[model samples]
Target: MDKHRNLDCKDIEAITALLSKDGEALNYYKTNGAESVGHAFMIANLLHLHANVSEASLFYRHAFNLHGKSQTEYPLPQSLLQVSLLCLLKAGQPVPEEEIKELEKYAPSYANYIRGILIAWRGGDVKEAMSLIGNAFEGFHSGEEIDALYLEIALKYFPALTAPITDTSYSPIPRHLYMYWDKNPPKEIADNIKYHQELLGEDFTFFNQENAEEWLFEHFGSETLSLFQNTKHPAESADFLRLHVILNNGGWWLDADLRLKSLEQWEMLSRLPKNCRFFITEKFLIHNDFFGTVANDPILANALLTCYVNMLKHHGLYIPYKTGPGVFSRAVSRTVYSSFNHDAPLPSLAIGTAWEMFSIVEEFEVTYKSGGNWHTA
Candidate 1:
């Protein structure tokens, strides 16, 4: 609190009065310092007088930026004064900046700091802006102080923003994201994991993407990130699935029309090296009732990739087929079928079919398919 000892008595009084209420007090402590239990006494007095909120937000922004940039190793009164600024802004008021003699002229170096303030003060998005600042800070600073300050502020406001995680209906957390449950492994899956103990025993400290992004952040050596949030098809190419898989994890992605097939298929599929990869039928077989009229879906079958159908059922059949524009995870939305190109150019060899593999072979020499074995031609 000593850093803000220069604050006028009237400003102090306004802040003290606001902190009297439990909610406002929590807000102050949240924005202030971690060791702020008894400090709320001064804050309550500030709120009782209730200074203009808009003006206070400016000071809060300055204070946070200052604190973040400061070399001082300890939390100070400057933090509490800034907490006043945050409270005022949270109350839907404007925050005014006292023109500083130190930065009277805007320099490019100082421009970044000003940008942070403006980003934080963005209307209707004060909390999001603040959190984004904190999240972005991890990208720029390796310092413990800034991270600690961000953690303190985030601890207060994120619970409300994160309430959706508990309600699975609206949860954005991906199925593949390392959830908290995956760390210890549930007792049932624990046994299954134990069966594969030799596989995972390579000694990776698996951090739940949900519970331990912080821990993962600490491991600067680790470049691994979960990219399951967006499933929208890329307009760039049919090969985006392959690139997407490579970027997120590694090696090749099998654009599988996956099913709970017989164990024999699983053994064969599993036997393939992760590098060699595998794809299920390039064409998916779905209920004909939903897609078309009769038991024989020659049109939709042709709509499926000829290579996929040939791989699954018959090698020699008069068929035209096309591949979906992008491969989508079934764990994601079932938009895979919808993403298939209805207007994809028909090959001279096949008409009125989603002929993906043959088209790739005709166009990009980079992609190929397998006959009974690997099809290079």
Candidate 2:
């Protein structure tokens, strides 16, 4: 397997730097001192990684403009054009019929895969789309990682799959309040952490970046560390990591933006009947951002985390669904299925009233340049 398969933020940054420097590598099709198509493709890939779809499409278009649309003499040029078209289509932009007409002209074999995904996206049937894509690519065994991302995208668009839980059993309340940061968070985020720690008092252990990293390595080993680090989206990485923490160590997990309504509310939550193994906030559908579970909780520890880890390994990495709320939402819905459909109930599950467990105080003015929208205050 390729060493670059486990690409992390650090690796991405290094590749970007190399591509930027003069005489580094991959400067194909430069015209009259203008940026080369190869350079544009590299930039587009970076933007894609960051989930900046709008900007990525612009760069993709720029690359296509430098090279004629119908050229298939080289693999790199054809791949760039394919990605460019996909990005535009995925963004819900109007793709010229001419562009669609040219897909098979370039990569005849790969065009079917593209067509399958596009048809699925248009029809709004994620399952159908996945089936078509699987068939198109011969069961998706060779490019399993990319296939995983395709499944995640399908899940994000059409997310109606899940089962519900009637009740839950909670025993000992876990004292761990786990949180993580890719870097030192903003001042507001820092203040939010301090305030929550004070309210939770001595019982809770606030696992910051260092603490979280140390504990992750200690318990899960280096493989877990690489998996966590290789996650293309930091917010998704954090989301998946929290599930693992609760599964392994049992605890309450909260996004940084979430705040308690009052100290009394926390007291009440702490004293809730210790029967439910998993507690989640919900109005109608379950909110992915905040939740709680004890160590070795079967639903979270086994099913939910298992599903997430498998998806991550198989899919490699993706945005929106795979690394975002999509996976969490699917997991919650599956918990419902496990509770009702299975002859044996999966685990004790409870839904928390929104404001009582935590209040989402939306801070509109401050914006986060990175991470998920839920991470912003």
Candidate 1 structure quality by residue, lDDT tens digits, 148-199 = 3333333233333112212213111111201122244335434433432333
- Give the whole-model CA lDDT for all candidates, comma-separated: 0.29, 0.53
Error of 1 at 151 (Å): 18
Per-residue lDDT for 118 in model 1? 50
lDDT of 2 at 281: 35
Best by TM-score: 2
**Whose lDDT is greatest here?**
2
lDDT by residue for model 2 (95-171), tens? 55565566567655446556556766576665445544443322222222333345344334334222232223333
RMSD of 2: 11.5
Q: What TM-score against the true fold does each predicted structure earn?
A: 0.25, 0.49
Question: lDDT score, residue 159, model 2?
Answer: 40
